[model samples]
Target: TSIPSLPGISTMESLREAMPYFELILDSGCSQRARQFLCTLLEPECQPLGSSVTPPCRNTCKVVAEECSDFIINILDLSQIFKCDNYPDSEDECINLARGDQCFSKETSCGDGSCIPKRWKCNGVLDCKNGIDEVNCTTCNKYQYACESKDSCIPLEWRCDGNADCEDGSDEINCHQEEEMVMHSHASPCPAGELRCVDGRCITLQQICDGNKDCSDGADEANCRIQYKS
Candidate 1:
């Protein structure tokens, strides 16, 4: 069900508790699409194939969020739960009101008024009609790997070093190496108890998996299981 949805409200109790916050938004009339958007999340229409509930379109979420940014962020204190960037920008099978074409959150607009997923921008493939998405884009050199999330690149050795050097974690997503094997780069000699990064940087054993990228290549905090203190 959409109750235990992407915001980590995983039970009926949590959904009930969160209802008042949404109700406030409904009462405020912050955006025209707020009611429909909120209802779609609350009681979703199920897909026939896998009984999956399709989420609201990223554009719809973006529209509402932009119009109601002040209320949602300052008053209700709900920016963390209402991140529009979490939604997919693809127009395929997602829920959106019947309107003229427009760009939404996590999407980039082509020069010819067409919208493409933001991830497709600067991906080396020409997805835009006028190629504006690729224009002025930062191309990574041979020694660097381009990050799909933004127009930036990290060192080639940073990929799959157990740390997410790329902001979107694309560098660490499909890594094939084991974590234990990845820990030992063997590139440089450390002072007895430290691990050597692929680029010859040394970090202490306590720094490993400690929720911080100590090494420049991010070998310190790779494959971590982030959890609550309780």
Candidate 2:
């Protein structure tokens, strides 16, 4: 043992002095050769958790080195235990586990049956009272909506100007996808939606001067009533 021995020191208090150097020996946790020398040097025990007569503590690990020699031995590779996802953490029935129940002023429960995150998903009649909760609910139809009042599963807002904002076609009805028009005075095609994705890449005169085509169809540099030098 390279550790300097103490003469009459007893209890965990004495063992603390030599631990820093001993820890340096196992600092390379991957080395088995180092471990062998450490085991011989420290002499730990492989005692059962509760079977130990001496209390286990930080300092006690060094003091009880011989008696608990096997305990300190990293003898084998052990896989960590993993619990199943669906398994309840504890078997105790005394716990009062409320999932997402919030405390309101009055004891009024939103009668959407299951307490899903969104109140609109609960049922047809605005369980959340405010229609905005259901206004932006997910919908599939382009012109139709999943209107709360109608409470129909299918869409109802289908007059496509370009937007499918609401089931009732009440929000922005005549919205178009806004395609860019091509120009003749200048060069380059200004396509509509294509220009949105790009920034001032290379646009043409017909796309811009004609107010149509700096973009995909000349929509990008379109509609510049006043023409400037290239």
Candidate 3:
């Protein structure tokens, strides 16, 4: 059945804004069937804006409801798809579905109502089903590189520093290749107080044999010949 065009429920944004009122109605002794219908209408469906089925209208509630009905019908028809009942039996059930998962202190809700860690919001990958998690993300800090995961931003200086700072390992992928090029090029000596390793990389002389392998080939700690002259 088609829903009537309701006042002040035109655009998707307006529908989202009206959700609280819908919830209030449900709580204020609305009929169980009415509440179930409203909850079904509220379920998220991928709707394209400006489609022929969703022409620009001052009140698109009827169209939206029709689309929602079709969406639920299609889901029910899918044999392999498993979802909660087509219509929530209670307001609490509807709310629980709307609040897909518990968010941590440093997390945010996606457009589809799922929660993701805040760090996964804008590193690069689209964690939100609607790609909303990456929208309006804060710009990376100066000299910071964005990871392919779209959830992390690492300092530019940290890239190729013999460490994997980006979760996708993008920061260190070509490090060895660059080092190989430097090795083949002119024999530029390391600056004062810095020692050159076998791989032509440079480290501070102080880093030698202090319980760490600074050199890639372990040359810094190859042999122990400490002499005690008392």
Candidate 4:
């Protein structure tokens, strides 16, 4: 005889109550794909409890039914697993997971229940507490370079600039090698008494300690220390 469908998972509370049964299914030698699908359904329960949201739970159930249909056919019924009287019926009642904070006209929700501006997503900064906003981003903005870990984004001009702008130091790695490769090909060099900046520009020594920046790379004003002679 076929097993009866498990209780509805339309709410976090119900989902939590159903976990042990799911775990039983997992331990009973379910296929790897079925196990992963079950884990996705259980993810929200793993999060800290907050104001209950139905859309994400419902969406997850939909994915399980569509993607794991064959695997779940005899083991569980999708209709009973997804049924929840409390599920939102009206569009207005469902909160948008992608909605931004009040300050931002557009926002996206993080896995941790925090909201951030849509523009901040995949911009390289970990605005979300769990860094979920920047995860799985395949591309970056124009003139922006993706970090070596691909977890963040930086400006293209920041690459190979002798500064560790990326969290992983990818922006400065191999910078000297690149400079050595192009040094002989470039005609730019400092004049006799001027210091050469990282960007190959020349500036007077006096400009180095005058509380002003003369080089595009700002190398002239960095690491200035006063010297004394007895």
Full-model lDDT for every candidate: 0.62, 0.31, 0.46, 0.48
Can you write out model 3's per-residue Cα lDDT over 1-230, one digit (the tens) per residue?
A: 22222222446665555555555544654222334335444443345875312112111122123223223223212211113233233433333322344543434678665554444566466756688976877566545765544566787667668888976675664444335434653378875435477687776533443346666766655442210111
Task: Give the poorly placed runs of model 2, Cα more than 4 Å off.
Answer: 1-85, 88-114, 119-143, 147-230
Per-candidate count of clashing residue pairs (backbone under 3 Å): 1, 53, 6, 2
Report the lDDT of model 4 for residue 140.
58
- In Å, residue 213's CA in model 4 sits off its true spot by 37
What TM-score do all the candidates reach, one by one? 0.40, 0.17, 0.25, 0.23
Per-residue alpha-carbon lDDT of candidate 2 for residues 62-97, written as tens digits (9 for 90 to 100) = 222322222333312110001112112232311111
Candidate closest to the true structure, highest TM-score? 1
Ten contiguous residues with the weakest lDDT in model 1: 221-230
Full-model lDDT, candidate 3? 0.46
In model 4, where do residues sit more than 4 Å from their true spots? 1-135, 186-230
What is model 3's C-alpha RMSD? 21.0
Give one digit per residue, the lDDT tens place, for model 4 in 1-230: 22112344345555455566666555655332335435433443332566443343332343234333333433223346544342343436543332234322334567654455444566567766678966788675655665644567777677767788977675665444234324532366555434566666665433443446677765554454321110
Model 1, 1-230: lDDT tens per residue? 44543455666766676678788888987666678778888777766976667777776676567556556643232464568776666767567542337665556677565565566677566766568877888876656766656578887677667898877786675343224534667755676545577767766543554446677767555554321111
Candidate 3 to truth, TM: 0.25
TM-score of 2: 0.17
lDDT (Cα, 0-100) at 23 in candidate 2: 67
Best by lDDT: 1
